[model samples]
Target: MSLSLIDAENTLASPVCALAGRAALRLALTILWHPQAQRIGEQFIAAAGSGDIDVNRFAPLFGGLAGNAQALGHRRIARDALRLRRHRDHGVSLLPPQSRMRVELNGAMLAGAPVRCTPEQVDAGLVIGLGGVVLLCVHWMDRLPQASAIAAVHGVGSAAIRVRELIRQVAATDLPVLLLGEAGSGKELAAQAIHQASARCRGPMVTVNLATLSETQAVAELFGADTGALARVGGGTLFLDKIGTAPQAVQAQLLRVLKTGEYRPVGARADQAARARLIGASDHDLHDGSFNQSLLRRLEALVVRLPPLRERRCDIGVLALHFMQAWSTRTGSAPELPLAFISQLCNYDWPGNVRQLGKVVQRALSAAQAGQPLAFDALVPGVAERTARVRLGQLSGQAVLDALEANGWLIRNAALALGVSRPSMYKLIGKHPAIRQIGQIAPAEIAAALAAHGGDTGRCAAALRTPSEALRRYLRRQAAGKLL
Candidate 1:
């Protein structure tokens, strides 16, 4: 209906014309401008000759009195002032003149406000005002490799595709990326994909899991007592994993650095600029009152939420086969992953996410190595029992009501019967609005049981052999709350 598609109809005879014409139209769309600007854009495009672009190169149009400009051979991209060259790992950077290059990121000034430049870079969708014409800064990674890799890791699900697309969209900019997901949901893989696809791929991605750090003092080992960690990264990416576990002191330090790009080491007296691009990952919802709100705001320049495994079950087989094939290649020979076995995996409610899937795959490989056949039972050693436990775990609204009744509205004993902890027992009590026991249970008996179990509902729940969460929920229907 629009101009480009109508033009495409005129070139139906030649395959090459269709392709080439479409590409030109795409380029034209990308450089849209108004009356005066359109004239300049046309002059710019004619001088630049087609404005055909490559992922690895950029060509400059105008030059100042100091020097003549040269183009990088990887791709012929249009621009007025900046010539960026892509390296295999370090990403792209300005080719010449060695002058300060300032970038306006969606509005914020990124580089030229006295911040020294580096080889590592990232850009999301950036609008650039070049001379009298306008342009968009495409993210450094638009190729298929990043897309295919994400699919292999996450799956073929629409969720995976959307996440991959998000990664591609943001990988090129200097924006801080925040990844939120359940444990083992491949947040790290997503971060890696961003780094690999960005202009910063050439630089090292230094990863530090705050949860794994022993204590506040551990910051010195990674961040240093002097001004060094971020400086050392020098245009690379610094990944902060499990950011929720950061000690208050560490949190304070992170807040300072991320806010102003000025950080002092654990013992350093002076503040220095951080050159490393930051990427933070957490399984927890960072905005919850528990974590520092200020830190969350600074770290979450761009937030990406990953769908848990249960939400994307279709990806299970794709990932399973991918893992099997990769392992087969690694070991030179491995058993084929049967469709039946793959289907068995797809049916699971993977609480542990992709991490659990990889572990299951590894276990399957081990079983095959020992001459054991791959099957549901072989791979899932206690599949039947786990299934039984899950069944028991799923007792419905009525079951919760009945359990409370049998336990005589005593939150403690009811939890015990349901194999749940006291706190869990109390929660179960709350969920049953009609099952109030505020005065029903004898005080003396409640006291006696609390004294007997030392007030440990977990101990009581264990004796009953029931999951705490289910009982906790139904009992809580009387109240219905608590962080799960």
Candidate 2:
């Protein structure tokens, strides 16, 4: 009995080597991050040489290390290890017998043996064994960041890691921060993270929704009638939600404050020095000419774009688990989340993003009966159908082209718009006779489009009906003299 390990890069390691390496990595992560390190260490020692791979033979060595780390009171390490362990357990329970699993670095299962288990059965970060066949899906455990650092921003995917790094980078600066993302996509969370990480952490963090305030009340609410948000947020952070919806007057006032670090309160004769660090968030495209350019420019000095939940599908499992843990802690009811339900969550295109997902998790937990796995489909009608992968065969070439053009030739966005997976969208584009890839377009044509669009890659992409990224690559190669 041997294990098959296919990593994100599609690299396959020898069965014995893969098992040994994976076990070592999981153990190391457990020691550094699991809360029940002592117990997990004991289990690791006990399970040595128990499975067909007999990879656990090295567990005792690593398990002892976890015990020592736990005894030293490293809470962060224990928490992360516990997260990885849960993910691995979930993944294994969904694995099919005698099937190779192709997994992404973020713990997303790309491909699994359909004969043994349907695509619906596969999950993220798994491990399971049946009759000498053991499937380990703990490869992502090694990539887990320090749990304490990210805190409220829960995710284990590469996208999440990038967001965390960006937060860390921007927190060191005092520039006005702009957060861009869809509604319910955690823009507020990103803003909170920035506030928590900044030097103003000790000061009050104030949040105001510009959209909720009327045009007449905007000035009074933001700057106040002698004493408002600006004064209230003194030396702290002022987070403006839906800044895109702000009226022209408010925008002018904000721009003045950003430029001169001074703003006059409503009905005030003199201007006061602004001490609060400003953070603006919006779901709308600020460049759409609705927002003031000066204000947008100032706010965007340190911008952080939060990826939508659909774009970070790999993080769905861990996020769901986080929500579940929170719900359980609040209600004292630990309802089980079925692998099938988690798979459904991963597959679904969450238009409302993380906030929406959290609500779904809450609803499921509330409706769940004792000792039964979460019935996601029952909680949300047509969820299974909506989440099911859309086959390319079901769509017309015209439909694909329409989706592509509508989304500015962005593959991922077009896929989401069409309710199809990215891969399926790619296949649809490839098969369409009207749609052309960057490679198929003549360099001269691209050059002309670039000129017509005034060197704007986005405009050129729309004009040429190709992906902006691919067009950029072509331009880069041409500039490097790699393409004629």
Candidate 3:
């Protein structure tokens, strides 16, 4: 049967081409069938092709190069061919009637032509046809590994399985995306990923931290000054980070940009210039009024919330392994993550999020270089006790006295050692009579005592621990005796 143009194009559209020249050839051939799909694909390739390359130059000559250029370039092409061969070898076929049966059937059909096959023959044919379709699908599926290997050879992450759906969704739109999460949640990374997946990936991505810029500076920074020089410098994307902390005026400036795609920088009186794209990020809750409401609404066109590390604890082990491999390759060291260390990392609440995890891994690597094991203690400092906060009210008189003696009656520093603020510490020391008495002691004598004790208070106190009350009573008695 002669193939219709629609039939030809439909079969050709199954494979998405990689080589620009080959893709153009396929499109040119398809135009004979359905001009529309071919024309659309042609225009895209024409726009992408630059310099000595054009559709006319590549279309007519692609077929002479040999067995499907795609098959030759893809790594598992041989394996796919083998699988197809195997399916053909194992595939069952419909049987033709023998000569005697053919004569009997012809005589019967002459009496009443039998147009339908027997039930067994029909069932067998249906099963074989279904098997062929399934095997053909398997052949195409097998080509996926070759494409993935090609991607790997080009230095791309093999996270395609996980990120494919998200990537596709992000690419199909030009909306302003707001990435929201806690600090170190990789909002910036997500922003770039979305930008890369979008149509504007070819453009640059400019990032500015709102927290680092003051109110006046932020306005000037986002909307360039009237001078065309600053505005003309960069034109890709304006990524605003920590949008929650951006001042009210800056938020207004950004909102204006989102509305109009234009901005006039700080100190500029010139008209606003249009921008390529706007992607914003926030480590704080902008929807909760941590940021300006109007600004949030303007950017709410597309909001992507990233879960914190604590919430996605299951991904921690995989993430940790990735980090370890990356660091090891960069530093020329062997991978050193032990199961116990990974367990602690997974169990811990990553308050700082991915940033903290990366830092811990780096620290662990450094420790390993210095002859230490890659353990949790080496990775994190003060993991058990983050900090100590004390309550002086809970201490007894004796305990208070003991603390005072331990600190040598230096109330300010003593309070620090005891983990209380300076003012509360002063109050505690002021209530002790011994502390007051120590305060009254002459500075010279105290210095002398300190020198004598070599700064050991207990030793000094044991030598001169007399009560002030007794000293006063003895002086009064001695004065009365002298008067009599």
Candidate 4:
């Protein structure tokens, strides 16, 4: 039986594909990146609309060199066979001779993301993973779009898309640019993208963090006759990282260079015109009554702001996939980051942002190569403890005890409520030593252990599984209540 495809939707109508990602633009981007999926999706949609599409006529969607040609397809696909079998749910029809596309999953992989089983009913915009794997249900109402040449660059989020557009717009100009964001928030990468896309794409790009260099060193590097970094960046791009940290004196010199575009090299009598365009970066807000005003004004000619990873959690899956592939290409070892790991990654509040994510991926990669599933403890040191702290604050004492008893005092099981790891759960137990003695000892004995610790929260917390600070706060609260 052939799946129907008439009067279908225009955009990504799949709930799964629409999952929290608004930056992917059109699912067509997914198809454009992987030609095989495009070809298959297109063929299946075409045949299904014809009213007599047969599953038998088409070979397996996968296998064969033509089908695996980077796995691209959809509307323009001809050779790769895409199948659609008529799915009769409970031997019933839910339509008036209407059309619908019934998609089936064959466990096709997308980067390292897990492919979810297709639901009983498939519609438009049903995306699979960050690997550009998508299932589209085309109709007469649908329109096939062209692939964006620039969309192929780094990000797959809406914010990233805008940033890329800005880069492309400004890359042709010679104006100085300022990038503002948190550390490891892709400012440097954006700068490089700018350099590569600019008219000076053929020239060299050099980066130096002013924060890393001494005041004297930074002056020598930037203005001291354009000898070292200045000489190296000769006719290309000079990326000054952590520009806010540059000394005031150096800022003044930089301002002069920006104004005149000429600096005398060390030991050189004549001044050389600065041909390299300047790109400055800062993680902190310079306008917050801190940075040098003159320098800030000069560097504020063109600005691009980057939102942190936590702000765009939707891209975490794709970023993780990209990081893994990049590492594999660099180290020549393909390490897998399954769906479970990507889910955990999305849940985390990465204070260090993408840099931290990269480091976590590296650690996980090392463990994965050795046959270890991505462990919570590997990603975080006290995952359980940190999670439990906030949750325990909300839970009543009886609720905590009930959770402990339900888990049979299994710290890891209890930690599920705490949203933490096993190690953190154990720490939670220390905060309430009575929890550790549950089922093994009587209530009287638990009190005796607490008393024997000399009301020392640290000792009692260790025996109990509580934070010493928390116990101290509790005692102070008790004392205040008594006075009241």
Number of the top TM-score candidate: 2
lDDT digits (tens) for residues 127-164 of candidate 4: 22222233322112122221223433444444555566
Give per-model TM-scores.
Answer: 0.50, 0.57, 0.46, 0.53
Clashes of each: 31, 11, 10, 37
Angstrom error at residue 156, model 2: 1.4
Error of 1 at 400 (Å): 16
Which of 1 and 4 is the better model by TM-score?
A: 4
Winner by lDDT between candidate 4 and candidate 3: 4
The residue ranges of model 4 lying beyond 4 angstroms of the native Cα positions read: 1-153, 267-269, 331-335, 382-484
Error of 4 at 454 (Å): 54
Tell me, what's the RMSD of every candidate? 25.7, 16.8, 32.7, 15.9
In model 2, which regions exceed 4 Å deviation? Answer: 1-148, 370-375, 381-484
In candidate 1, where is summed lDDT lowest over 10 consecutive residues? 40-49
Candidate 2 per-residue C-alpha lDDT over 107-212 given as tens digits, one digit per residue, 9 for 90 to 100: 1332232112111222222232111211222323333232236466766544576688789888989999999999999988888998999899999999999989
C-alpha lDDT of residue 262 in model 4: 79
lDDT of 1 by residue, 188-212 (tens): 8888888888899899888878787
TM-score of 2: 0.57
